[model samples]
Target: MKMRARCCLIALLIILNWAQQAPATEDVPGVGSLPPEVLKLLQDLNRQYGPDTVTLVSWLLDAATHSGSVLTASVRVTGNEAREDGTFLVFQIETGLIFNTRVFDQSGRLTVLWSKILAQAFAHLDTLQIPADGVMIDLLYHHKAFAETDDLSEHVDEPGSVEEAKFYFPGDPLRAFLGKKLSSPALLARTQVFINDTPVPYGAIRTETANGSH
Candidate 1:
């Protein structure tokens, strides 16, 4: 009888272990859906990032846009599938603000609180053409980056004003801006921004005449 009891205990342990590691069920009738409460949680998380930060106040289509004060965000639901790492909903966030150092970690499933904002860490608008003509927010970069290695680089402030600024040379607009906005003035990574044969944005500003008067 004692031997039978031990055997039963062992069987129960095995069953529990299997249940614990049973792959996450993402499609059990709305288990993975972005329900109202979950959406509210994401907004609250962003609030921890800043006072003006927010998410969807109202539901919209899969191809939707979310905006922040210093940035903008857009998320596109691609397909109907179980939750899996790298099965992204797709987001695009942009900014023109300078002097910020934001760290983001939004790679999760249930709580799509999947975004962060760094207003003061932004850089390099003088060199990078706005990807599109509009405001953007909290859209995290999808690439990994190295820490800054230097400490004497000048900061790039004021979009469309500075002549030259530090950045990760040869970077696309997104990378170029982050390289300067986030890491400049500290000489991080020996990064520098460079033009890639694209024409610079044009604007009109008051200029001194040949006679030396504005």
Candidate 2:
């Protein structure tokens, strides 16, 4: 009887090991289709910022634009809310001192919290030795109401709104911009703005010399 009980326990352990190594029976709703590298990065971010605080919706990288001297990329991110129920913050990082940002807020209450993740993304890109003539970043605050939910399916199909603004920086100011703390208003003042792709005429938006302006 003792030998039989020991064999049963050994069999249970083997089953548990197999279960742990097996893949999930169903994919995670929004992030299941992401590339393995991207999924790993998102998992790392979540581990740092509490579970489900940020989700990477999509990312594109292109180096053919400038004979390989420049890397053009776009990234879209959202809060923990359902993708259709929240804002999509889009970033267009390009060559030279210019970059573009657009905000598509599906729900006015939706906000994006991505400072840490963005920094990491840039750091990873830096590994390629891409020239940094300048940098453009979109900064925004997230509402507490945008916290994660266990059931994202319920938020699907919710009606929401959209807003977009683009800012451009001129000259090779990447080094200078990276050396100091970033301020959105100050940076905006120094940039040329476009709403829905229409350029805002000079002086239409107030301009200010950023502290340690590049």
Write down the lDDT that model 1 would get: 0.25
> Residue 48 of model 1: what lDDT?
35
Q: Report residue 108 deviation for candidate 2 (angstroms).
A: 10
In model 2, how large is the Cα lDDT of residue 133? 26
Off by over 4 Å in 2: 1-90, 93-156, 181-186, 200-214
Model 1 CA deviation exceeding 4 Å by range: 1-31, 35-71, 74-93, 96-166, 169-189, 195-214
lDDT by residue for model 2 over 1-214, one digit each (tens)?
A: 2233333223323333333344445333444444667555544433343221232111111211221111222332222221232322233432111121223232211112112223223222212111222233333221112224322223223312223444444322322234434433343445555545566654444223435432
Candidate 1 clash total?
19
